[model samples]
Target chain A: MIKPLTGNYAAAWGARLARVGVVSAYPITPQTTIVEKLAEFIERGEMDARIIRVESEHSALSAAWGAALGGVRAFTATASHGLLYMHEMLWWAAGSRIPLVMAVVTRTIGPPWNIWTDHSDIMGQRDTGWLIMMSEHNQEVLDSIIQMFKISEDPKVFLPGIVGLDGFILSHTTEPVDIPDQDVVDRFLPERRQPYILKPGDPLIMGNIPSDLRDNVKMRWDIHRSQERAKGVIRDVDREWAKLTGRSYGGLVERYRCDNAKYHIIGMGAWVGDMKEAVDILRDMGYGIGLVKVRYVRPFPGEEIAETLASSKGVIVFDRSVSPGSAGPLYLDVLSHAYIHGVRVPIQNVLAGIAGIDVGYDDIIGGVTMFINALEEGRWPLPSKIQWYFGGGEWWP
Target chain B: MSTERYLPLARPVVGVSGKTGTWRIERPVINYSKCIKCGLCWLYCPDNVIEIVEGSAEYVKIDYDYCKGCGICSNVCPTKAISMVPEG
Candidate 1:
């Protein structure tokens, strides 16, 4: 059934449908409403889950980690400073191979302290070993959360997952989201069974003894192999979800009209929606423009991305997170992929909408113009090119 | 009731093999020539892993089976009387 809902509400509903047994979280902007809705569900007796009130994001994640280790389907939500506070446990959760899911409401990390949307918060944890998936809209956010549980909990890929949505852009914005029936969701996602749960009669140790070099290498190798297994799990989960819900999503990377297009713009999160609008506008005006929205950021589907951009005459990468002294994180990944496969497509980088500033129609248009101009001149622009002000300095190259 | 600190279970399978491997305690070898009744190893051993016979401090030896190899006694010996070596 379709309902008008914000991304936070959609996530709450998705968690409900998945039958998450433990919900541990600390309130943080953009993601606060998500836990509020879950609390309401518990109070109304609509969902049966343990709601834990924690002192900080650290405890929230830790509690979730413990509960998941106890063989329960666990979840948590955080944003900006809160996510960073739980930073170390992110690796702990992933390294322990706990199949827990988290909703990271992407907000700008700050010194001035902003509560608005940006990719910096989630971007800071790019190497934490979690299966990171970005959502473009409320429906995708909702759907991906439920789907992430399936993919991450697969025996072959028992890795933790994080579903990231822009802080205010998608989290607070109201949109039409199809809330699947509980029975249908149940049919899709069955009860979780973790082989490591502690029992009275049967006991075992969890997350202990990283003894020596061989053990460390073997454990990390197991994580890497499990992560590689997630790629196929992602595709299979999306396929099964579509069979159940009649809605299909692009598994790892989504393509928008790249059949015969010369230029392909690549990005992720809510900004992909803005880029789509830009692509639609430019396509109508007779510009052979296309787009590729990367959904899974970690275990980054590098080969698939390289193959898609191989035929494009020009490419443009938009990153909302800056990597200080290096290229923007997303652009750097794309550029590195292109370089690895020897894809000789000229590319332009646009670093815009940082620190909770929203990426709107204007930024998309400007990015398109930069791509078009660069393509016409046959020159891939260097760093610090085609910048947007967004409360700072705007310099055109 | 006063609660006792948590002690690791002593399953027989884990006997001396597990004890030496599981705990950080290393066995201290006392060179008879190097020993001069310093008695520092027994005084500083946190787990009481060292046994010193006679108040004269003339004889000292480590109980390898019980000692958690913390290496504390090696640092406290005034005359470099004790040295630690890994369990066999």
Candidate 2:
């Protein structure tokens, strides 16, 4: 049935439909409603899952890890600092190769004390070996959570995953979501499988100290291999979901209007929606621009990105977060891939929407026009470094 | 069906640290003549080096090769039948 739901509610519905066995998470802004709705589900007996009341984000994920280790599908939700607090357990959960899913509502990491949306928090966790999925809207948020369980619990790719939605933008905003029937979802998702289950008589130690150092190194390699394998699994699962639900999200990165364009605008999370609109307007104004909205950032769509952007004259990468002193994370990934693919065309970074400054289609149109205009003039469209685009609507040097 | 895991998983086993008795500078001596087979030493051995035999007069046995001479067993034995002695 189609219903109006916030991004947080959509996430809660996704976990509910997937029949998550445990919900253990501390409440953080923008992420609080997700667990709040889940608590209501458990209270009303609409969902048959246990909610673990924990004092901190660390305990929340540790509890979920134990539940998943004990052979139950577990889930949790957090935003910003809550995600940062779960850092150690994040490594522990993925390193143990236990399958669980988390909903990360992207929020600003604060010293200035802002509760707005940004990708800095989730992007900071890019190297921790967990499968990361960033969604542009509420529907994808709900849909990917279900798919995340399938992908993570697959024996071929048994790593923990986080599905991210931009805080307040998607998390608090209402959107129409098709909540799939439990029967259809049941057919799509199977019973959560673990490499091994902890039992009373048969004891097993997970993440135990290895006897050989090379074995520890091998396990790290296993995580990397599984991640590579997950790219294929993610594609296959997206195809299956599209087949079943008629809602294809283009797997790793959704290619929008890239078929006959001179430039492609690449981004992830909520701003991708605006980027699409800007692409249309820019095309109307006669600048050949398209959109490549990233879905899965971990098993990054390198091949897909290379194939789409190689023939283009130039590429502009939009990063909601930067690595502080270095280039934007998404720009770095796209640049490396483009170089490897031998696409000499300039790929530039435009750091917009840091700490949730409102960026609309007009801002995207103005910024991208400046890029294409620069290209037409045979001048460097962007400097080697990025300046935060707060020009009110202008793309900067 | 090979039931190996995808990660470095360790199962419960004896001598996970590799017969740590090799690191011992002393040995635990169990005196069967003290005549108490109370099994406290077997129960308290940190390394599980002490064992109990139901059918033999040597009701309690110690695997000195892996004992590590921690004296945990000797300290816990109520009958004081096991003592830690300096090794050559």
Candidate 3:
């Protein structure tokens, strides 16, 4: 059934279908509706679950961790400062191999008290051992949440997965979403497995206990192995979901007409939707341009990316976050992977959006021009080191 | 399975002293006069560290070398055939 809902409502419905027993999250802008709807569901007796109103994001994650350890399906959502506040527990949840799902509304990490869409909040937490998935539309945000539970709870990949939707852009905007039937969801996602249970009668020690360096290394290696295993599980889950729901994800990174194209544009989150329109405009002008929407960022999708960019003459990587002295994070990953694959494609790195700055079509066109010029000149574009600003002013153009 | 699953720590290997199986709580000696066909010690040892003597009056034997001092056999012995002793 097609229901008109905001991205936050989609996320709430997905969590509801997953039958999350405990939800412990403090409200932050753009992400508050997810928990609010969940609380409403519980109050109306529509959903049989515990909805906790925690004091802070830190306590929210801590409570979710405890509930998950007790062998119950759990979830939480946060944005910007809430995500930053829960940073320590993020590592704790992943390290303990608790299969909890978190919705991260992409917002700028603040010093100036801004609450708008930006990738820095989630991007800054790239090393938190969680499998991160970016949502392009409200539908993806909804579906990704349900799929995240299955992906995270897989025994081979017992790490947490975070679904990221741009705050205000996707979270607040309403769109058409297919809310799966409850019976269908129950068939797709059976009860979560309790292999690592923490029963009161059968006591077991949880995380942060003292252990030898070798034990610690073993734990870390398993965490790395789980992330690597998640790469394959993510693809497999997408394939399976397509069979059940008649909807399929493009897997890892979704490619758009890049097979025979000479120039490919790369980005994540809501920008990809804008880039799609831009790709069509460039394509009609006979520019041979395409787009690669990076849905999964942490696993990096190196092999698939290398193959996608292999035949392209040039590639432009649009980053939403910046590194102080180096190329943006996305640029480094794509360039490094391309180099390893022996592909000599010129990569133009463009730092377009930062600190909630709106990335317009002009920025996209300028980025494409740089990429084409680099290819024509037979030179790999230098790593992006520009800082964009407001007031129509130039700082590092 | 990866090598990491067997060892809780990331190291390659651990020495025998680190192995918890070598410590013993009780040492059993065969008493033929009190021996019966009942194999209570062999059935009750949690670590499966007990052995039964074959065709020698069905006496029960405990392998003290691998026991971890978890006293289950002594408590389960119905004939007072086994006793718990501290291992130095």
Best by DockQ: 2
Q: Docking quality tier of candidate 2?
A: medium
Model 2 chain A poorest 10 in a row by lDDT: A379-388
- Output the TM-score of candidate 3: 0.80
Q: Across residues B1-88, which tens digit of lDDT does each residue of candidate 3 receive?
A: 7533421212222233454656555555445576675887788777776788887664666655567767677677777766666555
Q: A149-179 in candidate 1: lDDT tens per residue? A: 9887888777899999998788999999999
Measured with C-alpha atoms, the lDDT of residue A312 in candidate 3 is 82
Candidate 1 residues lying further than 4 Å off, grouped into runs, are A382-393, B1-88
Which digits, one per residue and each the tens of the lDDT, describe model 2 over residues B1-88?
A: 2234457677887777776778888787878788477777877777777788997888888886687888788788788887888999
What TM-score is obtained for chain B in each of the predicted models? 0.62, 0.80, 0.61
Residue A160 in model 2: shift from native, Å?
1.4
TM-score to native of every candidate shown: 0.82, 0.88, 0.80
Interface RMSD of 2: 1.7
TM-score of chain B of 2: 0.80
What residue pairs clash in candidate 1, if any at all?
Answer: B24-B69, B25-B68, B25-B69, B26-B69
| Worst 10 contiguous positions by lDDT, candidate 1 chain A | A388-397
lDDT of 2 by residue, A1-397 (tens): 9999999999999999999989999988989999999999999999999999999999999999999999999999998999999999999999989999999999999888889998999998887889999999999999999999999999989999999999999999999999999998999999889787887888788777777898888778888888988999999999999989999998898999988888889999988888888888888888777899989889888899999987899888889988987879999999988888887877778999988899999988777777777778977645644656874764454
- Chain A TM-score values for every predicted structure, listed in order: 0.95, 0.98, 0.95
